[model samples]
Target: MSRSTPNTAPDGSSLPVVHVAAGVLIDMQEKVLLARRSADSHQGGLWEFPGGKLEPGEQNRDALCRELEEELGIQVRRARPLIRVTHRYPDRAVILHTWLVTSWEGDPRGREGQPLSWMPVAELPHWPMPAADIPILRALDLPDTYLITPPGFKETALFLRQLQQALDKGISLLQFRLFGLPASGHEVLARQACRLCEEYGARMLLNGPLKLARAVGAHGVHLDRRSLMALNDRNGYEGLLLGASCHDALELEQAQAVGVDFAVLSPVLPTLSHPDAEILGWEGFSQLSQGISIPVYALGGMAPDLLEQSWKQGGQGIAGIRGLWPSSV
Candidate 1:
């Protein structure tokens, strides 16, 4: 989700898109499998998820199963869509459809005479992987649910109680977004929230200025569109998870240029809170995934039940306030 450019050729003409299917196969101890590309082949010497180019009209799932058997000698028992990366090189553009192979039969080895390795999931980021395969690592790290804090808290004590309840229910990622609050109020609230998140092993992203997000000890900073644009150098934000609110391809590109870790695409469906807001509908939501290489969460009108549907349409997960918040509380 960090870097990307427009998918066009040197002459500014559109390039033919190549479709490939890849799989993230994990061992019993939960290490991810990666294959090294042949030294003479494209992106040689770099490790990648096991996969290959898809034949015309071949379904992604079918290609994954066929490729896994051919390349690894394993039968995929269960698999699900993980992420789709659309990357462009000077000569070609590629749409890499990745799947999570949860269960399989037979051991995985390099049948194509290439080397294979298994590494801890956290160590994947340090491996020399192709730019397109980096998003797959981020997808593997993200959870299935994201929680946004309630906008207004009438009583601070009551809000902390609700926040603790949500944490206890196992919501590990949260956004502390409160409108109409002064700087002093934010500082006080953020410290208390940070303590609770630490106790429960959850991460809290402050939805405010970066300075305050750091001073208050937040795990990350979640930027709205304007703040996302203001960011230039990413050096100051090292080790903090940077997320953004993106609505269109342009914003997504900007988010990538600014080194954002993830994004939340909103208004996937209508909401009572903002009745007049335009909804993306599922089809529109899917289109946002076309050009970007980041983990995106469906944000408006989202609930637990819609998690699978969001995944099918190429989302990292679902993020919400009313729908997800009240339930956990």
Candidate 2:
């Protein structure tokens, strides 16, 4: 009998782990650079982001820079960590340290005789891509911040005014997080919120109870931790975009297993809302996110300034109530 370990083959041999650093070069037109893989290599005929494997004792940034210079005749001037993904094939496993390169020195010529294309993010889906690269696509599609509506929605006009302000300030993703409203109150408020979100071209999610999301024509539903755990039958979980609030690795694993569109992992930093709560910090957050296949947002104490920090720490973005809400509101 063959027993397969997490990182071991059925034959009792360790699977080789390949460490790669890939770069997504963005142009002013909101397109990302993709190079066609060699017909002789693995995942041939598929388009991919440019990068190479890391050498022994080498850093990810160093490997990324060196590979870009060698393969594309360019030097990365500005780059930010986007996502880290670990995937296993039949023969081996791979860990990708992906970065978004906004600025570079030279024109990116395919020095390796590879073909390159500047493809829009929306169009990239139509092209066949490696399974390992799919997570990167998800990250690119998601916004850098998620807004949770402030707690005082009982003042309906004031809440709408504040929400409009937040949207005008460039919040493309939102969650209507106000709680304790009557069903009738919820229906009324949700319809108004949906209109505002539509005007701003933003996607809005209702917090939990899938029926409410459908009734109000929300773009998605975000399940609280309790609701996430209570789900038993997978039979009725489709047709709408879904998200979940995850506190630890177990909840995060379940979030992915149940096919959430994204997740919010909270308490990454100390915050006024949960003053004494244990914080995950960057290390803990990264450890949790690295295993997650879907987009994961950092929640506690996040702000505009911390957006890049969240990206570098293996997050899809930052999600928060106070951190994202307008101070005037």
Candidate 3:
């Protein structure tokens, strides 16, 4: 539903070529189907939300039927619009139309010889995915808040403990992001944090540390803008939730391509972290959130009290470290 870049022709020419891709959202017992791509292709070996490029004259549903059949060897019995996104990669531009297809026939086999897997929704954060997919993940789970944090250390430990107390008071989903910590220290803190999250039955997303997420048994991994732009597709990891931090519409589309669960659209308000960054006010936030099928948490200077306002302006919730862990809301 978000467009990061303007549309363009696909043949490396100036003529406009609107690329339409149709995808199906297969929900089965809380698990969804995903496919891996051949590493040699545009997005090789990456696991992706199963769907394919649309051909000329094909309706959205018709295109979905064809792609699912060709790629997964299955027939969709029912399908409905879920979301639509437009992303322009350097090499290709695509308009992605997605549908929620809850019913189907035949077991999903990777007809293209790409690997196939059924992933549980709750476990979506662990995969290595494209950045644009994050919002979709958010759409599926609908977490109330996106918790950001500084590095894990003795000083931040108190903050985390305070966060833990907040979790006890009903903050179920959180991200343990420490950009400044050493790898070893991060692992140690992640392991400790995982214990707390598990105790509270809360979900934790590690920012930019897929390996550490696995090592510490965290719920999932969060990708920043840089990590996502580099990925061609998402398909490898068998089990895990993948999240992303996205700044624009194109990134959100890419996140969807790689099957990210949810995303954080930042700078809803300016932060001390980057005082010069332009804030995406409620108007801008609404514009972005409107196009996204997945839930979007308004980041940058979010406070607990902003929840109602965010939802009113088309946000799922608010995500922040300072506002989330403060002694008062």
Which candidate achieves the best lDDT against the true structure?
1
lDDT of 1 by residue, 52-79 (tens): 9887667888899999999999999998
Weakest lDDT window of 10 consecutive positions for candidate 2: 1-10
Candidate 2 per-residue lDDT over residues 225-317, each given as its tens digit: 998877764445576667889999999988877777788998999999899999999889988987777789999998889988888788888
What shift in Å separates residue 173 of candidate 1 from its native position after superposition?
1.3
Candidate 2 residue 307 Cα shift, in angstroms, is 2.1
Query: With candidate 2 superimposed using the best TM-score fit, by how many Å does residue 148's alpha carbon deviate from the native?
Result: 0.9
TM-score of 1: 0.91
- Please, what are the lDDT tens digits per residue for candidate 3 over residues 1-329? 22223344432455444444445455647787777778897667666778776665666677788888988888889765544544445555555665667788888888878888888886776876544454455555656687776544456568667777788778888788775767787688778887888898888877765677788988888889998877666564346767788888888777756777777888899888779988888888878865655667789888888887776666767888777764642
User: What lDDT would candidate 2 get against the real structure?
Assistant: 0.85
Candidate 2: residue 18 lDDT (0-100)? 76
TM-score of each: 0.91, 0.91, 0.58
lDDT of 1: 0.85
